[model samples]
Target: MANRPKKLPKALQKLSKPRVDHIPGLVIAAPASNSGKTVVTLGILRALANGDIAIAAAKAGPDYIDPAFQHAASRRRCINLDPWAMTQDAIRDLARWHIGASAGALPDGQSDGQSDGRFVLCEGVMGLFDGAAGGGGSSADLAAMMDWPVVLVVDVRGQAASAAAIIQGFANFRPDVRIAGVILNRVGSPRHRDMIMEACARAVPDIPIIGAVMRSNDLALPERHLGLVQAGEHPELEVFLERAGAIMARDIDLDALLGLVRTQGTDHGRVAGTNGNDGTNDTDGDHGRDHLPEAGSQVQDQAVAPKDDGAAVSRYVERFAQNNANYAAPVTIAPLGQHIAVARDDAFAFCYPHLIAGWQAAGAKISLFSPLANEAPPQGCDAVYLPGGYPELHGAVLAAADCFLDGLRDAARRNLPVYGECGGYMVLGDCLVDGDGISHKMAGLLPLETSFHQRRLHLGYRLVDIRQQCPLGNVGAVLRGHEFHYASTIRADGEGWLNARTADNRDLGPCGLQKGSVFGSFFHLIC
Candidate 1:
């Protein structure tokens, strides 16, 4: 028998039309990691959004910070489209979901007069062509995947006409990826912008000059041990976004600029009913031959299954029914799962909000534990999560906290799942040698020792292939994550337990180790 019919809300049914057109969008790309891309993108989005345009925002790769800024600028829920971490279908679905949510509205809710025109603004990653180690899955790759036009955000500093040459190379380097326009960022003055404009006009006349943002030291956001401070922590973030929007609106020629972008077609028809068929068969079939049930009924039937593809479809239908669900539901852990205690303090706070949200949404109760307070795992905590942070800074305090150390050791002995990131990875080691060559005691759960004295900057987004069964998942399973730390950890006895490797096939030594239930890794998983 076919799966039961999923009931959707009346409001959602009324607004069920596809929101995104075949028209390709725009991706604001850069040459490197910090090239004022976020500020420029935010300015563009805010300026356009202020004009009553229905806007959908997306992050090009596995980033949590830029999306937050995008959300604030566009006044919409920004979605992350990581080619490595998420499937192609997931990327398209995310775009369509945001487009749909932004285009339609309830009878009683806020409605901007004309709702037909929906535009998507995708913010690119580190560099335009840089991707995971093997050289695939770059921002350019994502732009090609979505058939989006590229709006390069070039930081116009230290070079004048050389910037134009760089832009020219990027434009001609990849024939398939479209470079629509350029937004000159960090331009020194009006004369600086004029020089940049003239250079670009001479070197790459085909690429239009959209906007030029002046250099402003005051606009810089503060950085923490991690990347930029989390958007939530920035109280004046909205104010900054507004000021940025005003600046762009005043300076940029929004209408003429947007007109330069060519709309490319997408194949959305391929994705319509391919969500594992949760009984949304709009096809002609024999009604008497198959016993079909209601939408919620089908969901109830699959409620007991460990991983139900149909459940995701049913959940989608339910969200459509509610008419309040915004972004597409991400693939998550099973609901009614065991509880996990996650360490979340200033010293160890690199957990992804979505991962935690996904886990909680999947029915895993996340209990927040603090190592800085020397807090023990709460009663009945089934698992422990120790994310990356500046544990090295609090080495003395952590060593002094015998209770927290003893609790971690006890948890390890009890066979509870204990996952750790860079800083957390050090915590599980026998000892940590600080920058001054002073060693401090740790939990000694793993046969490893880390040294901050001899610092080596290991930074990149990694594609991890699971080599053994552990709390995360099965062997040979690939996961998208990132690694950024200044410490070097080597096996004390030259024995190692590394799992994944870089895109170049070079082993990223012992990303994850599993001894009984004790698991630790320097890689921070995004999905």
Candidate 2:
């Protein structure tokens, strides 16, 4: 017997009229950083979700923070789509997975573009055209890959009519990329809004004025050195999202914006894009150098080994365009153990959702605990993962957590895999000096000392080869990830774990450290 289709609730049915059997979506972009695109993206996501519309969100590039806020706004898991670090197929697969996961499994013949009335909203990173130093991984690349129209969020604070020139230039910049609309942010007054709108209409009449957002303090989110404060730490987050949504609902053209979204044709309209060039002149046309480890070394493989077939380390080489190879194809790194304990709190909140999702997909169970709340990792867990976050801000409190510190040491003694990244890595050290120059005792599992007082920015995409066997991977296993931290290593004494180089081939030498079953680095794995 054929089963009948389940009907939506009355509220959802009322909101589902305009969706024409397609999972409509658009990329919210900006001319430059701090152009109010993040706020606009959050506002739109919350507004649509509030209207009983199913929403899925993603962020272009390797950003762990923005996706957290996007997830909070849309009430669904948000994934990072990094054109620099991830292949086009992986990006599309992630998008499809996110949509299907959010809106329940798609019907037998349905495609990503034909969802159950769910809308996918992607927030662009940095400037629309800005990418890695060598090129590729820009917001423009993601938009072109997805065949979605871009809605530019122009910050109109310092300029009025001149804003149209920027819009016109971008509209004609790339013949392959489409500019569908504009959202005027930080409009001074009615006269200022009128002037910008009139200029845009006269200059780039094809690009519609999607919205004119007035200047307001309500939409701004607090920030720390790394990025915006974690969504979990925001006390009035609900109120802030509601107010932002209300403002977007009042000012933005919700219906017109939806109209600009592209409906996919089974292949998700992927054929139109996928040239794999992210607008950079790099040799790979993807991003920085992809260094496969040196060949002819073998070691015992563990749960944390690369999930794909075992391959000897191949020497680092520049990929030319002859074969048009995608060196950044996503690699699934196996989980550390069957049951992994992850620390989660305001101080330890920089974990990536996709990494966790990948772990679960590989048949691993994740148990979360809070060090800031004086909680320890769950008992009987085989491994512990401490993610990067603002541990420097709460150094005193973390130092006071006796249970958390003791449990971490106990894990180290038990030879359980205990891994950390950046902030997490700092906590596993002997001592951490805060921004105020005060030293706090930390878990003495590793012979490392770091200081926030003498901060130095260490930020970029990293191509790393495992230097020694650790829980992360076997020796000579190559991996791709990112590193962004302000803490400086004050003192260290241990064997190097990873031999890393920046995306552009700048040698970073050996990084992080390893001792017994404990190992970590400043870099956060992306794949």
Candidate 3:
């Protein structure tokens, strides 16, 4: 008999209301990566939020942090719309749900219904035209699909006329995508702004100039090894956003900007599935294609597959879709009857907020457990979760923490679900390789060994096929997730237990390994 079909989550089943017609909005796009699009977009969101404007935020790609900042600026939860990660149906549903006209008084300071119309602010990823490796999945693709106007955010630090050429190329490169206006970011002075604005007017006369933000070293966000510091870690993030918004309000043309944006029409239906029809059902039939592998397929099947860089790009696109769809109908896990201690100190703080919410929704009580200050998992907790974070930075302190190590050993002995990711995965190994080619003794829960000395950036979205039964779910089940880590573990002297691979079939060795009650891997589960 064939395997049973997986049921769609409750969140995905409900049909959303139709979108409101003529809803004003604009998406902020840039010429390339690191163009300061996020800063400018967030500043606008904050400034508008201070008024009577009922603004909604949407991200054009699969980013976790920027959306958090958008959420802060808009005083609402931001939604993601990625052309690659999700089906068109999901994106339409999200747009319809949030794209309604405002009726009540402003939550900020403006009188109710002053800026009564609804507006969405979408922040673009990377470059506007730079799609994924496959060349089709991009922020521009999303703009064309939604028919939303695009506001170009240009960083005019070095060149003036050259910047105009880049903007003109983007405006003309895609005839369908409308470049509604421009936001000059990081301008040096009034003269620099004037030069850029004049050049842009001459080159792309159709696209209006909205704002020009001057250069400011104060706007720079803190960064770590991976990217911008996670928003959760930065408590002063609100203040930073307010400062950026004030600067933008002082420098940019706020009212002229509002005039340039064209409201989008209502009509939230999806462009039928790949079959090219107009319906909500998935034509591909198979859902969670990114997660589970076909049954009876060995790891060797993936070993010989052609290297399609497009697969990586598609995974990135799919992330946006998945995020939006999941939000429409959030997965509610079984409740935690007993308290589950989670490690959440600076050394182990890389857990996704959704995962914790999932656990709590499922009825599991959450109690934060700190190992950094020599604190152990709380007594009577049923399970312990050690998420990925900067364990390498505090290797010596962790190596010397007897209480934390012993507590983990006790939990393992008691047969509790002890799950870990990237940094946490390293802690569960027999030994961890430090920066100076030295190995530090860890919990030794798993038979794996990891090294941080020889670093490599292994980053991408993933689909995990459950080869064996563990705590997360049943055997043969698939899980949506992502992998980003610098350490490489060598199986020094134990049986390998976990197996993983990228969406395009590259080797991702020993991701979800389990030994008794302890299970760990470098992969971060998003669902």
Candidate 4:
């Protein structure tokens, strides 16, 4: 971290400076999944931003999707703070840096100058107490480590006064983790809200009711198999956010909630053990992966391809550009090459921001291309990285993307370092079967075939020991990552790449394959 650049690139200058000693922040968590925490988090972020409060958003664990929506709501880059995959120092460093980069001297790093007055709003993954099978990485873990208060978003759809039991359980779950407040979501009626409010007063009177969100089908975001069909794919996303913000601002006590934020503390960072796991296999399933960069005109020229709907493509490109503008200040990791072409777009969008920013910090130039747009890896890139995304949904489109497929094959022929993960890995294989049971020809760089139709949930935290020299690192270099995808391998050939295991130290034997310079697996790296 000492080698990290003192100044961020010109592109990142837009983030307002943060208060070094006191940037107010809180962790917005819930009792369980579908408690409407994402909606509530987005609403609060948008509402606060609307009221002229500069906001910084973060997601707990290794999720890459929700942060994109969080960024959209806050009009800022949203970073993932993973308790499981990163060290305690790494977690605190990332959080401090993200609160505002210009704030001076963090515990582990230094930034120059004044405060931007940004309030960080971090959304929790799944349930608050949920973490990996070994028990470490959870929203509660993050809240405790940061010494910040948690605002529980409890879904009160079916029960009213009984919601007090759920609130009391979470409040007393961990002594170190404080449940400062609660937001009752999906309230049925005035009576419903009042009943829950009265019960909480008699039970957990120390904890206050932050808000009671009225039930509304309109507030719900659309979802497909993976989760909410990505914030990027949503039509009228801005309208949705605007409406949600207005509702939250009207219903919630923003000032009271703000009071719960730990505004003035430098010693809040307390050390915990480095090893953590994202709670449960289903935790990753709910949160999704790959928060994309803010889209901007910089990508339009090279990233967007010719589609049948020209006007639609233009709008999509413009929206995509909004999220692609800034890259985070780098945290160090070894660069694969001097220049790397990374795949992005709806098809291959699971690349981590830290990985990209780290590459840039390590002095590697990154060029992005869209396989969904029929684009190839940019010329002159010494290496290519294909990240995980929803390739199965667009199998036919990718099969028809001749330029993209041909360019990938050409890169492999040149013996360039080419790596893929999950969806990207599926594309590099000989063939892929979509959910409709239609098999399409792929890049054919690896002697493998996969099927999204014949799905099987292959998930959980992975401790990969690379058995061969590849893009990640030297042989025997251990990496902590995770595998969360439904694409089953139909056929696989070639030598094994990684000797992997679960978080609890169970052997998974050989994972993924390597042939020449091209290799991939379903594993997604996180650090």
- Estimate TM-scores for all models: 0.70, 0.80, 0.69, 0.81
What's model 1's TM-score? Answer: 0.70
**Candidate 4 similarity to native, TM-score:** 0.81
lDDT comparison, 1 vs 2, better candidate? 2
lDDT of 2 by residue, 114-230 (tens): 222244588998999998866778999988876667889999998987999999999889876777678888888767877877787578755667578889988899997888988
Off by over 4 Å in 4: 1-24, 102-117, 262-332
Cα-based lDDT for every prediction: 0.65, 0.72, 0.64, 0.71
Ordered by TM-score, highest first, the candidates read 4, 2, 1, 3
**Tens digit of per-residue lDDT, candidate 3, span 1-527:** 13423332233333233233333456789989899988888888887787545566888755656776777777765766666555555555455434431222233223232122245578888899876543454788888877777878898889999889988888889877877667778888767766776676578755556566778886888876677776667878889988877877665655545533321222211211011112332212222112112222211211101222123222322232223322322332232235788998878866554356546645678899788887888999988888888888788888888899999999999988888888897898888888788888888888877888988888766667776677777667666556777887677454334567665656666555788878877777654
What's the lDDT for residue 473 in model 3?
Answer: 71
Better-scoring candidate (TM-score), 1 or 3: 1
Lowest-lDDT window of 10 residues in candidate 1? 283-292
How accurate locally is residue 420 in candidate 4, as Cα lDDT from 0 to 100?
89
